[model samples]
Target: MTELVRATSGRSEVALTFHGAGDLDITRQVLAALAQHGAYVTVLAVGTWLAARPDAAKMVLDGGHELGNHTWSHPALSAYKPEPMRVEIERCRDELVELTGSPGAFFRQSQGQHATAEELLEAGKAGYSRVLSYDIDSLDWRDPGPAAIRHAVAAASAGSVVSMHLGRPGTVIALPGILTDFARRGLTVVTASKLVS
Candidate 1:
């Protein structure tokens, strides 16, 4: 798979990627905030999350946002053998295809871990052409408060892929300021695909 840690568009744009599978309510809140700002993002969703709330996945697509696999469950894929790893990735892809009529164009590993070479090859075989990594991690998972989250994202430069999580309340709280900061800096937030394109 083509590994992209950052976009290459060279425009005043950054890609905001959210990893989902925890809280649907917060996910909706995040989506709403993004929509309110006319910003589009990429959500890497866990398969179980989609199964439990297919409507949430639909909500993302309906909002004109991009979706990708974050594995069947959030597991450290590198811990598994090659075949099991493939199962983890492909199961998520299958669920996405079944739900959305497409498996999406990118794959993001659980916990934002870097995929091993074998994992990358398996992901490609499963139909995802790109494995996405992030240049800036919001660390919102730590519930570091809105200010810290804002600071982390505000520091993003051009071509950055700022990683954030969907279930975290801090992320929802910090999104408005983050978007405003991006706009203030003359940056446009785009999807991962759009950033690379």
Candidate 2:
């Protein structure tokens, strides 16, 4: 498999990947914001969350965004043993397949930015050839102010996969301005797969 992070220097695409496990209403607003700017993103969803909100899969896909497995319960992959780790990856994989007919091209380990060695093994077994990690973290999940979240993500450049969250109110508030900044910099927001592809 290819290494996850790319060095596509001339590429204009910067991926805004949302760790999905939030209220349906919040996700709707996030999707609406993306729609307003004609941007696409990658949502790495937890299986338990996906199963709880069955409509979320289609909601994301319908917005021309991508959905990938983020694990079942979103525990730290490094803390899991082989069997449970395998289950964590595959269970979400199964949910994606059942809901969307295709498990997305990416898998991102939860509770961390980088993948664990064991997480990589489980991701491969679950048929994800690429694992998406981020270069910029918005830190919106911590309830930082919208300006602070905007400042954090405003650093995105070409080939950047910025980490953000769907459930974050600050993220929703900051997204429009962040998109404007990206547009100002000539950076196009695309799905993580598209950023590398």
Candidate 3:
């Protein structure tokens, strides 16, 4: 099957997913904002980041967010050969399993591009059912300020899977406004797994 970019469940719901691997302080801020709005997200975490801060797994899961593999070093997985690619995917999966008792439900590649055939194969080897992708991107990593980030995600609608980054303060700043906009539009924000389900 192809990578999932959006859900076709015919519901007025959207998923907010973040590229995980950032400062713990910023992550805490992002979680606090989401908690304030009673929203949940999926964090596709980098393995190096997880190794550096193993507590981050509990921090994310405890805040009602789930974790997924984004590879070991956040490199473009497609650039590597099959052996290294498998290592990247499985390494991150191992980290997740070690910390959270599971490899998570999805595998999202570094850089948030659509998964390649090789990526899907390696991901399957690592125990992922689907490669989670996104239809909308907030571009918060560019640090274009909160307004730009909000404007970018403002395009989300039902079935939209929005791509965001967790390591940036701009995302944390723009999150509440984005959630407010969704609330005003009568849309429900859900975790990626929920959106796909």
Ranking by lDDT: 3, 1, 2
TM-score, predicted candidate 1 vs. hidden true structure: 0.97
- The better-scoring model by TM-score among 2 and 3 is 3
Deviation in Å, model 2, residue 28 alpha carbon: 0.5
lDDT of 2 by residue, 1-197 (tens): 34465437678889999999988999999999999999999999999989999999999999999998899999878898988988999999999899889987788888888887777877888788888878888999888899999999987778888988998888899999999999999989998877876
List, residue by residue over 56-75, the lDDT tens digit for candidate 3: 99999999988988999988
Best by lDDT: 3
Model 3: lowest-lDDT 10 consecutive positions: 104-113
Give candidate 3's TM-score. Answer: 0.97
Higher-scoring candidate on TM-score, 1 or 2: 1
Candidate 1 clashing pairs, residues 3+ apart or interchain: none
Which pairs in model 2 have colliding backbones?
Answer: none
Better structure of 2 and 3 per lDDT: 3
Question: How many residue pairs of model 1 clash at the backbone?
Answer: 0
Look at candidate 3 and tell me the lDDT of residue 113.
Answer: 63
> CA lDDT of each candidate?
0.89, 0.88, 0.89
Clashes of each: 0, 0, 0
Q: Per-residue lDDT of 22-106 in model 1, one digit per residue for the tens?
A: 7789888999999999999999989999999889888899999999999999887877888888899999999999999999769
